[model samples]
Target chain A: MIMKNDIILAGVGGQGILSIAAIIGTAAVSRGLYVKQSEVHGMSQRGGDVQSHLRLSSRPIASDLIPTGAADMIISVEPLEALRYLPWLKKEGWIITNTKPFVNIPNYPPLEEVLATIASKPHHVMIDADEIATEIGSARSANMVILGASTICLDLPFEELEQAIRSVFGKKGEEIVHTNLSALRAGRDFALQHKNQA
Target chain B: MQKMILLGDEAIAQGAIDAGLSGIYAYPGTPSTEITEYIIASKEAKNNGIVANWTANEKTAVETALGMSYAGKRAMACMKHVGLNVAADPFINSAVTGINGGLIVVSADDPSMHSSQNEQDSRFYGKFALLPILEPSNQQEAYDMVHYGFDLSEKYQIPVLFRITTRLAHSRSGIERKAKRAQNEMTLPGDLKQFVLLPAIARRRYKGLLGLQPQLENESENSGWNQYTDGPDKSLGIIAAGLAYNYLLENFPEGNIPYPVLKIGQYPLPRLWVEKIANECETLLVLEEGMPVIEEMLKGYLGNCLNIKGRLDGTLPRDGELNPNLVAVALGGKMIRGEEVPSLVVPRPPSLCAGCPHTDSYLALNEAMKVYGKGRVFSDIGCYTLAALPPLEAINSCVDMGASITMAKGAADAGLVPAVAVIGDSTFTHSGITGLLDAVISKSPITILILDNSTTGMTGGQPSAATGRIAEICKGIGVEEEHIRILKPLRKNHDENVKIIAEELAYPGVSVVIPTRECVQTLNRRMREKFKNKKTE
Candidate 1:
């Protein structure tokens, strides 16, 4: 079985991009599948645009980097961050992005236009993951929510992801794990509901 | 075999741990920092009494690791590519001294300047020292090669340079474990003066080292790490060294490249295989990262030049890094590119944190510099270098670690009076103090601003070597005690800080102004950790 998924996880630095990768990467590794995750650390973690290339496959993976125009999907926690990695996406690749705008830069373009551009993609899911997370009582779980929304596009089972959440966040205490799980399920539900919508 | 999903740095650390490393020493640096960090945090290492230390600087780290190796215990020293420059003296000298215990110097290079000032490959440093170089193509190799490298080092009684780039350093993949080896028992060298570099013995040792080159190349050929696989398409021969090998394979997803390929994981060029492929194929494609060391070496006499294609010939861009697409394009294929990034997406450059002390310090410095005009502040490496870009635009130069002080002194000598030098606390100890002494002895009219953030914030808040000692260090360096002023870098103290800065700038002699504050990120992290413990209660 030749199973493979190349994902580009994008967001503003410190938005927990690595945490999301930890969850998915752990899930894939637990299944005894091949996993390669490349991270951006050091200077860029100080509130700059950052991205991680996460590859999962049944067979041994060759490259740590996802080749240009070969990513299976782009899962972004911020709207503008979503469009930053368009070059890495496949022709029919899915783009799952949060609707929130991280306006750190002075000249961040209009949010509506960014959202509309994401909307123009053939396969896209626009989500208010921050709002969904906040409504569920944990604003910090927005990244988990975004990760949850991308699960539909990912080939892994939901139970595998839920187990991954438990293992990755196990040391942080049960409350955080619960809140993040709720955020994840809420995000997954939103994607399930709005996946086919115009 | 046990499996662990590990970053390449972590894999190397684990590899070293399993290979019976008695100690590891390093100064924190991107890509390479995690290697020492992993060992420091390992429970097994603690149980086994393995020593892991964060040294004052790369030079000190290498010397300390060499001391450990001197005791007949396996030791490792790690740092980024440029850090090797700081440790070059000991590193090169160690080659002449030989070793009783295995010594591996791991240099994590940044090929694309991802988190570095420049991209300098460490393999050349290895070759220059006449030592075998191991360049792992992936995480598993990164792990296995540690054992192989240690064996090679002990076998030859010489040091091995293990080079890795930012991608391999930062990327994570599966790594399989080998059986654990016991640490070497303390045993002195058979000769008492083995380490002493007296000219009489040095010539003999140097000759011995020179004699080891062919044997080293033979080891490279026989080592399983270097492989030469034949392909049906002999028209274009490919030499993919280190991580470039992975990219070549990535371009061929089916694992079938239509060319004769030489995979170079261990270097000294793996001469026999190189000559074999060179003789068998028509044209050669050198797909190595960083500079074209292989390509340059291949272009030896122009007599046997077989149309070598790489960075030198512009087949691939001379600068930056090599990805699968770049390799694909070099192989006469079109690179895959999708829609261009929309104009709406502005560049979000990395900046200081919202409550960063560097922000307030740079702000106050900008106000003081208004009187002296601009372009006199020479900033050194650290988070404050981010001030080079932004609303502050406070600094004019950031050349390297601890360059700010010397550069400022040079400018002052050249009649740029009131020249300002901005350096971080950690960097000051790293390389700044001697420059400070130089300024004091010469009595240069330079105002030095040391941004004391109490921690090395750039590389994830490693413990600083200069914590709480900047003032005393300055006073000890012979700067006038009265001129060495410490100010709190905060918004409420902005005007006062600016006043102090201006007054120091007007001083005729050397003056050190320290803006002391805890890094906002470290502070936040501490508070979060404290809160988490409370929650755990």
Candidate 2:
């Protein structure tokens, strides 16, 4: 059977969406998957809501952008950002979003309402990637933690992601790679336990 | 063959490096910036002695590329769609003075206004210059096109216009590489007077350029990039150009679309192929990114009787980029969608970073402008343009690069006293210096705030041309030495900075206040290496 994973990665700009993309993309490439990840650069880098359409397939993929209502999953680091891509998510699509709210706008909705909207989804995983990353002693590893939480929905093996975290962050140092791996496991463990509840 | 996943920009860079490129010049602009950034980061390019310089502006970059071309070596200059306008003088004239070496001018158009002022197509500019244009359908095609483009440029002794949209520029995919060719040795043009475009000489060169049109058209027909595929259905023929071909293919995942499809990756229209397709189908659907250049061409001045459907005929939206669903719906598919976005999710517009120096500088400028009232401040391009939004709402206008200074001068001429112009440091060097010269010549009473964050912050912190040299440049540009105040744009220095700005605004002549600080993002990027070093130790 042909395998395909069309994920929409969403978050506030400067919130490390591209970093998460690097981990997932690196893993996808290692598995001999055809990958097409489109990103937002330039002005949006200054703390704006940014989304990247990441498509990976066993065969050749065409569109860099995933069509409306066709995304397999939306992996976001912020709850509010996760809801913004509702139109792009498939009916039975999985939403793997962090429970933490990145409130940069004055009119940002109440955190409870944002969480409630994400919670209302049939297939979803809400993990506090920030809290988990902080607990792992690397607050900046929140992006990796969120990527880990989405592994349940992703067809790829969990071990592949851990290996990716090492290769992707390996340049920074062994310490970073280790911390990111810890953060990834912390997020994955939480998702496996909460999959049924979600 | 080796394959690596790379963005479209990186593919172009890699393709150039592999295809015997000697130098790459560019001004940092969205989409196009990454092309040069890739070259700068490539260790192979460095070892090969390829020069990648971020020029002061697009114009300088293009001229530098032309100079390298004059020395008989492969050279490339890239810029965003608007940046092309700045580089137009050299870009257009380079065609008249036919090149000796391979020269490719890459312009990345941003459709849908993603990170641009307008979605102007660059193919029209290529057509105007009468140059062969290459638009890649995929990342691999993008990489392949660069090698092909260089050969074509040298074969015809003319510059090739390489156009790509935001999607292709920012999009990443696996690209297969070809064997690397050696860079050209330094040499001179065969003819000594080739570049001198005097009216008499230019007339002869112009004729030569125009004479190459038919051959170029024939070349496009056999280029292999402009593919013609036949399908059983003759009722409708589809014309998918550049990146739109990918979206068209997405709708037909089984590798089958019934209608005959003509994938146009090269330009000059290849009239015979167009006519052949036009004759075969009852109706034509033209799918192209940016404007409907080909569609409009198909519907000539007399308005052909062919039922051509595209952006012009409402088959596709007149504005913005194309997607797979849009192409599907245009092909008579249903409008499929999922859940509506909750109304509670408010707009989270981009703003200055947490420790952004522009935040403090804009705050000080806002406080200084209190007595002068609103609508007096004009801002230019860059991260500082973000200040036009709330809660700072510091600037009033953002038209184009270097427009802030000239617009402020114009406004001050119209009796808007104390008209303040807020321009970024890189932008000041790009086009603002000349505008400042004009202001100083007339002694315009406008106070200018040169927000110096030390890098081109908007395009991801490429090394700035205006770094540490802003004060000296302002002085050199005829600004009164006493009136050019350079201050640190910090929260602690906010009160003093505001006072200085207010004093500058009170001056009867042109006064420049530069609030200098390193961009937070650039600072963070630099510190990461230090952090890594500490960890390793």
For every prediction, compared with the true complex, DockQ reads 0.87, 0.88
What's the TM-score of chain A alone for every prediction? 0.98, 0.97
List the lowest-lDDT window of 10 residues for candidate 1 chain B.
B299-308
After superposing candidate 2, which stretches have Cα over 4 Å from the reference? Answer: A196-198, B534-537
Q: Candidate 1: where is the Cα deviation over 4 Å? A: A196-198, B301-304
Model 2 native-contact share:
0.89
Clashing pairs in 1: none
Worst 10-residue lDDT window for candidate 2 chain A reads: A189-198
Cα misplacement distance, residue B244 of candidate 2 (Å): 0.5
Interface RMSD of predicted model 1: 0.7
Indicate the docking level reached by candidate 2: high
TM-score (all chains, Cα) for each model: 0.99, 0.98
